[model samples]
Structure formats: C-alpha cells, structure tokens
Target: MKTEKFQTILVSASILGLAIMFGCAAFQDAIVPCYISPDALDYADANATTFLPWTTLFDARRIDRFMDFRHLWIQAEDNLQYNFLKGLNAFHIRGSEELKTILFSPTGPIGLAFPALAGGALGTYLFSKPKDKRKIAELEKENKK
Candidate 1:
C-alpha cells in the first residue's frame, strides 16, 4: 500500500511537471496585447524617453543590464525587434508619444516557474488523497442492513 501510494505520488509529480512546463510554453506563445499604464508613461516622459527592452528573459530587479537574460522578444512601435542580448541603441521608443503597442513574443522561459510550482502542489494534494476502501465497505454493509 505504501509503495503504491509512493508510486502514485511520483507519477503524479512527473505528469504534472511535464504538463505545466508544456502548458506554460504554449501559453507564452499565445500573443497577448499589453498596455502601459498612463502613470508609468508619465514617469517615463519626465525621465528619459529611451527604455530597456521588455523581454521574457528580462528581470527588472536585476541590476545587470549587460547580461543576456531576456526570454521574450519585443517588437516596439518602430517595428524593430529587441532582445535581451541587443539593447535598443539608435532606436528610441518613447513611453508617451511614440509608444503605442508591442508585438510581444515569448522567446524564452518567462513566467514559467509559477505554473510548474502550482501544478506540483496540486498534483501532490490530488495523488496523496487516501483511498478509503474501508469506508466503501462500511457503506455497502450499511446498505445491506
């Protein structure tokens, strides 16, 4: 019984992990339009107009801009492609005026961990549920009586 339970857990984890990984990959591939908040644009207008490329691999918290860590491919209003490795140099995209819409493409592992972690937790909960055969037997006995 213990071994069966363990096997169930292991299988569940593997299946869930693979499903989450693939599902997230597919979800990322789906093109979704995003709009920049007006406040953010106002801030950008006040500051420098030029901004970093928002890619899937980009971690806003990371201080290092030199690192090639972008996962998504960003196409700015200028119809230019920007990746993590190549910083927007001559092409300037303003947040207020020139800024319109981006052809957001997920080229790398962006927002992948969330689904994987969530799926694993769900799988553990589902597979670890005890199969109460005794309860069923008791129910059957009560029905007969």
Candidate 2:
C-alpha cells in the first residue's frame, strides 16, 4: 500500500513537471531571447517528445510491473500445466492486484495464448499414450490378465 502511494506520487510529480515545462515552452520567448520553433502550445505536436517520454516511461513501467511474477499467477490459472487434470479452474492462485491492469493491458489480448500453448504442449507429453516400448508392454499386460 505504501509503495502504491509512493508510485502514484512519483507519477503525479512527473506529469506535473512535464506540464510546467510545456507551459513554459509555449511562451518561453518572454523569458528567453529565442522563440520556440513550432511553439509548444500549438497542439500540432501534442505527442511531442518533450512531454511524451514521461508518459511513455510511466506506461512502460506500469506494464512491466504487471508482467512481473505477481501477476503471472493470473495468467497461469487457465494453464494446462498448472491445473493438470483439475479441470478448467485452477486449484489455487497466489496473486493480488487490480483487474484493470491484468485485463486491459496491451498484451492482454494474447497473453493467455502463450501460456496455454506451452501448458498444452506439456500436457500433451504428460497425458499422451506411451511412446516407449517398455511402457507399451506394461500397458498391454493390463487387459490380458
């Protein structure tokens, strides 16, 4: 909780700093000799590198945190490897966070597919009929006697 508050403060401060810089740049000629080339308030460049990198950094940090181990359990819940033969639902999940982050994230669309693919491959090997001759012979004896 404390960490979340700190992160919020840090993000707010960064955005505040960016707004101040943009406002200053818009009419910087009054304070400085040279005028801005395209003008900061021109909205023509709302995504200007000057103010955008700050937002981008914050966005990336948010995604990176979401993609970390804590949220990994959410993605693992539907995984065949995690559930094994337990059916569709996971037996237990040990993670906590906002659903918006996990559900609305940039990678959310396909995030589930990768784990499902991997787990399906693992389940295929684990649950498939035996390829080994020794195991095949052992199975063949069961119906005979």
Candidate 3:
C-alpha cells in the first residue's frame, strides 16, 4: 500500500513538473514578440536622439563604431522597457490588479516563482528514475548468462 502511494505521488509530481515547464516555455514565447518588434527601434531612436551630439567628439571611424555600439545598446534597453510596458498592458487588459502587483511590485511573487518553478521542473525531469530500469537490468543479466 505504501509503495503504491509512493508511485502515485511520484507520478503526480512528475506530471505537475512537466506542466510547469510547458507553462514557463509558453510564457517565454508569448513575451518574445513584445521584445523583438520594430516599434522598439522607434522608441530607441526617439530616446537616443538626445545623446546624438556626444558621438561628434570622436573621429569618423571611432564615431561610426560608437554610434553603432550606442544604437545597439539603446535598442536593447528600449526593448526591455517596452517588454515591461507590454506586460503591464496585458495586466490592465485582463483587469487584473493581482498580476500587476505580482509583476510590478518589488516584492512580487513572480521574482521568486519564475526561477523556482523552472528550476524545480528541470530538476525533477532530469532526476526522475527511468520506468524501464528493471527490464533493462533483467535483459543485461540474461545476456550475461
């Protein structure tokens, strides 16, 4: 009875772990479009115009490299900011102050949940015992015999 219970618990935990992994993967995919849109470039361009004069301090080659580097840096920063705003917009769209609190607040559970849930799911999947271990062992023993 105890062994049966243990098997049930293990199966349930494994299923739950897989579900969490899939949910995390889906969440990541959903946010990717928000990070990669051309609108992010427009946002960066508008913000970077303020700092354009700083590039003039360098020679042409150096100025070119600096602008290239600066543009990439600004675009990356803008994408991050836009993704955050997109998440906030999603929360507002859902009419969920709960998600806003979870995502926007410094003490939000999302900070802990994302890493912990992902880690737990990965650990469970990688460490779980194979279902056919005994069969393989028996085959090996027969081969040896």
Candidate 4:
C-alpha cells in the first residue's frame, strides 16, 4: 500500500513538472517583442514616428530610439542585418558564458537529476513485477491468528 501511494505521487510530480517547463518555454518563444502602449500614445505628438528595427526585445521596459541601427534580426527574413556582424558576436559571447557555467559548475548535474529520477520512478512503477499473492495471503492469515 505504501509503495502504491509513492508511485502515485511520483507519476503526478513528473506530469506536473514537464507541463510547467514546456508552458514557460512556449510563452517565452511566442513573444512578439514589439508593441505600442497607452503611455506612448499619450506622449505622442503630431510629429511622432517609429523608424524600422527600433522596437527592442522588451518594449514595455523602455522607449526605442528615434533613429538607430536596425534591430531586426538580432535574422530578419527580409531586412537589413546588423553592421559588422555585431549581433552574431554578441550571441556567441552569451552562449560561451552559458557553456562555461555548465561545464565548470558541479551543480550542473543537479538540473539533470530531476528528469532521471522522475522517469525512473514512473518506469519502475509501471514495469515492475507484481509481488506474490500467495505470500501476502499467508502473511495475512498468520496475522489473523
């Protein structure tokens, strides 16, 4: 009975954890990254304008420059790319930092442990051999005496 309850908890935790991970990733990827706000409207004048590629990754956080380099790609399918490959360089720099952290940190494997345990628990629970019914029956009879 205790084993059954533990299996139930493990299965429930695996499902919930995976669901949250995927949901958050989806939300992050689907962001449009550019939009006008009510505050911007209030500040707007007859001469107000937004040049191309000015809308940044987070528009709500700050106002974009009046006329700046193309913010399009960061690869815009049909727009001017960043001058001198600066955007690509920035991307590689950030990726290098991430790789360094994962490679150097002992705790990197800590992130991997969750899915390992969750999957192991669920798989064992599902594929494990059943206990002998005869043994359980005999034990119960002995207890009754």
Candidate 5:
C-alpha cells in the first residue's frame, strides 16, 4: 500500500514538473525577438544621414518637411518593433505571473488543492467497490468441490 502511494505521488510530481517546463519554454520562445531584418537598420541610418545635408541646402520650411518625414519614418518603424516585443513580453509575463499567483497566493494553494481533491476522489471511487465478490466466491467453492 505504501509503495503504491509513493508511486502515485511520484507520477503526479513528474506530471506537474513537465507542465511547468513546457510553460517556461513556450513563454521564452514567444517573448524573444526573431523577425528583425538587417536592411531595416541600414535604412534607418541612411535616412538620418540624408537629413543632415538637407538642413544646410534647403530653406527652413523645406528642411522642416524633410526632417519631419525622416522623424516620422524612423518613429513608425521603431514603434512597430517596440510594440510587437512589448505585447509578446506582456503575454509571457502575465502567464508566468498568473501561474505564480495560483501557486503562492495568500488565500491558499489553489493549484495543488484542486488536483489533489480530484485525484483523491477518483482514487476513492475506483478502490471503494469490491471486484466480482460473488464470482470469486463461487469459483472458490467449485474449485474446492
């Protein structure tokens, strides 16, 4: 009986450990940036360099227009990447935080309690009933005869 209980505990622990590991890997992959292109950096630098010459050659209005265009383009690209990473990071962080909250809340251990109750109930139901007692008894009597 003790060995069986120990095996059950080990299996439950292993399953929980696997779940945590999977979650961690998924979160890491999702939040890490993977789509950055080298050309985008080159373009940004070129725009900045081109704006410098315009400030000297063009009148204030024309210079202002060029500068405004450069600034907007740079900002748009940066904002796109920034917001993408921010959203991914936020989703991953929120998932981890939620797991932590469920595991270590002040109220109680909500994570383990539900699983424990479910397992206990299932085990109880499975083990409570005797297995074909009348058949076993009849077979024993026939064998004795």
Candidate 6:
C-alpha cells in the first residue's frame, strides 16, 4: 500500500515536471536580441576576417563557468546565429558587398544548418519519451533513505 501511494505521488510529480518543461516551445519563450552594426564595416572589409573561431566567440571565463550548459544560452545562441545569417542575406539582397562576402563565401550554408537541426532533434527526443516507472521507482527508493 505504501509503495502504491509512493508510485502515485511519483507519477504525479513526473507529469507536473514534464508539463512545466515541455509546455512552452523551447526557443519561443524569450526574445534574444541580435544586432549587426553598420559601424562594424570600419573593422570589417572584403578581405577582413569576419568569422571568429567558435572558441573565441564565447568567453573563456564564461566557458569555465559552464554558461553554455543553460537552455537560455543555447536558445540565445541559436537565435543569434539565425538572425546573423538572416541579416547577412537581407544585406546581400540589397547589394552589400561586405555581407555578400560573409554570406556567399566558400563556407556557404552548411555551417548554418548544423545547430538548428541538432537543437530541434534534441528537443524532440527529450519531449517525446514517456516517463519510465523503473527510473521513477529507483528515485523514490533513494528519497526514502
């Protein structure tokens, strides 16, 4: 009887947790501001290196602090990437050579697709799995001690 009661509580908590987690669309919860300065053109030229390496894009101290581990950072990074590419394309369409170099360079759109696809897949996998009773029972046992 005790075990059954524990199971009921466990299942209820799990449902609540999942509901809170999966209720909002992952990237839709907050706005991430993305900007490209026209003044950046002073430092960026057709021959200038606009793309920074991934490591340099994030701060070393922040990396040590594990800033990337948070969902907010992940979502913000995705928004930044999407906005950057979208801005570049918009600029190029309006005949901006500097943006054209950045947008249509040798690298192309391959890099852009990776993160968007990976994040979508991860969110899908996390939300689609049903709660497992085995894991719940194990957790309940741990809490009893």
The per-residue C-alpha lDDT of model 5 at residue 15 equals 97
- Compared with the true structure, the alpha-carbon lDDT of candidate 6 equals 0.58
Query: Tens-digit lDDT track for model 4 on 39-143?
Result: 553453212233335343344333433212223422463434544477788989999999888865656765577677889999987764456567778899999
Name the better of 2 and 4 by lDDT.
4
For model 3, the stretches where C-alpha displacement exceeds 4 angstroms are: 1-58, 96-145
Score candidate 1 by lDDT.
0.49
Work out the TM-score per prediction.
Answer: 0.22, 0.22, 0.27, 0.24, 0.32, 0.21
Number of clashing pairs per prediction, in order: 5, 0, 0, 0, 0, 0
Q: Which candidate wins on lDDT?
A: 5
lDDT of 2 at 134: 69
2: Cα error in model 1, Å: 0.9
Full-model lDDT, candidate 2: 0.56
Per-residue alpha-carbon lDDT of candidate 2 for residues 51-88, written as tens digits (9 for 90 to 100)? 33333333333334444644466568757565685543
Summarize candidate 1's per-residue lDDT along 1-145 as a digit string, tens digits: 9999999999999999999999887755233323344454343332212243342222222222312222122224234543532455434534423333332223223345666778999998776444566777789999999
- Model 4, residue 137: what's the lDDT? 81
Mark the 10 consecutive residues where model 4 has the least summed lDDT: 65-74
On a 0 to 100 scale, what is the lDDT of residue 103 in model 2? 60
**Candidate 5 C-alpha lDDT tens digits along 42-127:** 44343322234322222333334655687898899999999999999999999999888878775558766877889999998776
> Which sections of candidate 1 miss by over 4 Å?
31-145
- What TM-score quantifies how close candidate 5 is to the native fold? 0.32
- The number of clashing residue pairs in model 1 is 5
Backbone clashes in candidate 6 total 0
Per-residue alpha-carbon lDDT of model 3 for 1-145, expressed as tens digits?
9999999999999999999999887655333322222343344333222233332222233334555777899899999999999999997878776777778575677877878889999998787567567778889999999
lDDT of 5 at 35: 34
